[model samples]
Target: MNENEKIREEILNTVNGLSDEQLNANPEKGRWSIIQVLDHLYLMERAITKSIADKLKSDERVQAVDKPIELTVNRDVKVEAPSYVVPSDSFQTLDEVKDKLAESRSAFVQLVHNADENDLEQKSFPHPLFKDLSLKQWIPFVGFHEKRHLLQIEELKSKL
Candidate 1:
């Protein structure tokens, strides 16, 4: 399959077997559960859609200081995104979140395929954590972001 298709399949495979408790576990004070992570995925898909569809500036921002430009640069963001993401809403149930995640992920893949040179060339708003993640660079970030959560979910599962 092509690059977008490969990314789509990888996402489809990664999030397949989450449990309710695992989805609900907040991990720490004011953190997201797997369900929230799924929701964030959906939220991200929306952001990508908007960003690509019209070159629309990110109408949204993560919590904390909103260092969106971090996406454009290269920094270790695995810690910062979680640290800054103040949940706008409570975590939904696993079934609900995953269902939407699947759909949104497909949309994300479609968006990636539709991207042009500028989309790939233009960097994400500077993120507080990572830096230099241009649109093209962010492709891996898209997958990596989910994988990071999947690992977190699994680690949380190990304790349970």
Candidate 2:
């Protein structure tokens, strides 16, 4: 399997069998709960997929940066989630969040599969933190983003 698939599986494994209470409990003040993190992940995934689709349909092309993945996956630089992608309290249960996450992941995987390999390196979109990233870079960036939140989830879980 590819890196995306591997990371997807890891994400599922990380959150699997978590109780609603565990998912909703905040580890500390002014921090996100496990479900909130999942909600953010789903929101960002959908947004990124839409961004890539829009860029693919456009006639514009941009230069692919060297080591774009390195720039995105760096954990040292803290970035705030844009208001558009922030998670809401609409999801009442862990199951609801998981269902949306599964749907978003399916859409993201399909988008990656349907994209042209050659075009992936040519097309670009603005990342909240990384400025501009090619389609190819964005795919793995999703997994890396998930992994970052996975650590947060683990920390939240420990607090319970």
Instruction: Tell me, by TM-score, which candidate is best.
Output: 2
Candidate 1 RMSD to the correct structure: 6.8
Q: What is the number of backbone collisions in each predicted candidate, taken in the order shown?
A: 16, 0
Candidate 2: residue pairs that collide: none
Q: Candidate 1 — what's its lDDT?
A: 0.55
| Candidate 1 deviant stretches above 4 angstroms | 1-22, 26-30, 54-78, 82-91, 122-124
Scanning candidate 2 in windows of ten residues, the lowest lDDT window is: 66-75
State the number of backbone clashes in model 2.
0
Which runs of model 2 end up more than 4 angstroms from their true locations?
71-74
Residue range 43-148, candidate 1, lDDT tens digits: 7655655555544244442222222432432324445444333344564676676677678767766777776655456435443355434556555656555555
Alpha-carbon TM-score of each model against the true structure = 0.61, 0.89
lDDT of 1 at 79: 55
On lDDT, the candidate that comes out on top is: 2
